[model samples]
Target: MANKIILTGGGSAGHVTVNIALLPELTKRGWNMVYIGSEDGIERELMTPYTNVPYYAIKTGKLRRYFDWKNFKDPFKVITGAYQAYDIIRKEKPQVVFSKGGFVSVPVVIGAWLNRTPIIIHESDVTPGLANRIAIPFATKVCTTFEETSAHVPSQKVEYIGAVIREELLQGSAIKGRNTLFFTRSKPTLLVMGGSLGSKRLNEVIRDSLPLLLQEFHIIHICGKGQVDETLTHQAYRQFEYVTDELPDFLATADLIISRAGSNAIFEFLTLQKPMILIPLPTSSSRGDQIVNAASFQKNGYAEVIPDEQVTKDRLVQTVHQVYEQRSIYMGNMQKVKKRDPLLAIIQLIEKTALSDRSRNKKEK
Candidate 1:
């Protein structure tokens, strides 16, 4: 029988991209892959094209740091999710399991542990997420995007393999991207993204500053699903609800990025050597991972960050212009500080861990 592996992660595209990046390589290595995620989560939609990989959905509860009514109801959901995951793992009998830390992954990691399956979890931020924090004790290895993350995780199990950039993303063409949207070809393009779910505040500020921005830069706004404004359709500004195949092209056309400081997305920008003005989620609303990620990039001269509270039309426009003016500096810094892509190293680790697990299992048998 062929070697099998179960992949788990959901809630955000970030939680799944590493696994996605590894898929082609995994297939090349002759491993059959299965995915376990929430029934209606973004992972299901994102993974739809890989029809060969069967997807299993388990009931998942949100793991929130703040108080909410769902907190009481969600633990039971997590327990059920674990039971479902256990059943799946038992039947699948995979050599190893990989989890990209999200609430949905916690149960899968626990289930894999119960089944004595080796688990590898990837953490994309300098600070470990809540789900990964809970899942770490059960993981055989934890792959991290940032070297600084070692301080937050157990040094023994953590490895500093950098962010996985998808192969397709690198194949984007600037000419193709320019042709996709008819615009002032000579003007520089600014790409704006508010994450998978979209950011209301980020959207509002950008829309408010559009007039001033459009004069200097063509705007391509990925306004998240259902966040598009039907009322406004300016020639200088184009808004997309969401994009898949055309994403690389859109990214290719961008001279500057305006984005939330999510580690996975920002790292992609860094790898592309794109100058950016990052707006991080406020600590009051999030665990503030973005704040740390953004600060690190800014301190290294790769990007400039503007706090949410400080965002206004004048500041936003001025900041964008400032970042654009310093584009060469950011690109140079990005090139200077660039780390080797960790995809190959991570695949080797996965194979090694799986081989060892299989050997141990055979001995026990």
Candidate 2:
């Protein structure tokens, strides 16, 4: 019988992308896989077309960070979702569960714990989310994208693996050093990204600051779907709503990047070893995690953080010029850092854990 493995997580690309990078390797190793995600989240939409692996979606709603009277029902919803997840796990009897935490994954984590299943969870930010924080005690192993994340959780439960960004990024990092996407002059290329939807604030700042950058550098802007039609008619900006296949090509070619400090994007920038100017979303971010992630990246010397309230055309221009002027120094700083081979590490972890579980079952038989 083939070894079966169950993977669960979603709500955003930050959580779901971890699974995207790992799934292909699991399939290559001949493991039967099933993906568990929230019915209404982005995961089911993103993963369904790519694989035949069965997907089970449970009804889930996001829990607000701030206290509201409506918060009273959260535990009840979690309990219901947990029972649903428990039923799914019992039917599949997979060897192990790998969860990337979000509110949607809470029930699944609880179910895995209740069922005596071995569980591994990945935390992508310097600060762990409430779901991951709660699930840490039940996890067989906890992997973190930042060293700081462990400070908030028990040290013994964490492994600092760096963020597991998508495999396409690793492919983007292979060669071309600082010149892949839009190389005009020997001057650095600047790649702009604002989450999956693009950032109106960052776009506005960049739009205002474009003339100054255009004189010295090439710009590849992922305006995201929302701003694709926005009037960014600047001669210097090469904008796209989405470049699904060419994103890696753009990153590989960039010398510098202007982007939001999303966990997945920041890790990709570091892995590529490029200098970046980060504009983190407001403290009121939907997930309330981007602020911490931006601050953490600044502390680590990987990037410069520009808070949303402080981001302006002049500041954006000045910071871009400052980083460019000191390119050699910043690039050297990035080179001093070590990066994980996300694909190899994730693939090994899943294959080894699944095989081990299979071996134990065989012994029992």
Pick by TM-score: which candidate is best? 1
The local lDDT score (0 to 100) that residue 37 gets in candidate 1 is 96
Candidate 2, 1-365: lDDT as tens digits: 78787888887777788888887777887878888888788788778776668999886656778888768976787788899999999999988899988887888988988887778888888777888878888987788787777787777667677777676676864245334443455566788888877878787788778888888877888887768646565545688876666778778777788888889888788877888888888877656578888777787677888889998888888998887777677677778887556567666676677777778778989
- TM-score, prediction 1: 0.98
Q: Per-residue CA lDDT of candidate 1, range 53-109, in tens?
A: 999999999999888999999999999999999999999999999999899998899
Model 2 C-alpha RMSD vs. true structure (Å) is 3.0
User: How many clashes in each candidate?
Assistant: 0, 2
The TM-scores of all predictions, comma-separated, are: 0.98, 0.88
Which portions of model 2 miss their true places by more than 4 Å? Answer: 67-75, 173-188, 286-288, 355-365
Query: What's the C-alpha lDDT at position 314 in model 2?
Result: 85
Worst 10 residues of 2 by lDDT: 173-182
Query: Candidate 1 — which residues are off by over 4 angstroms?
Result: none
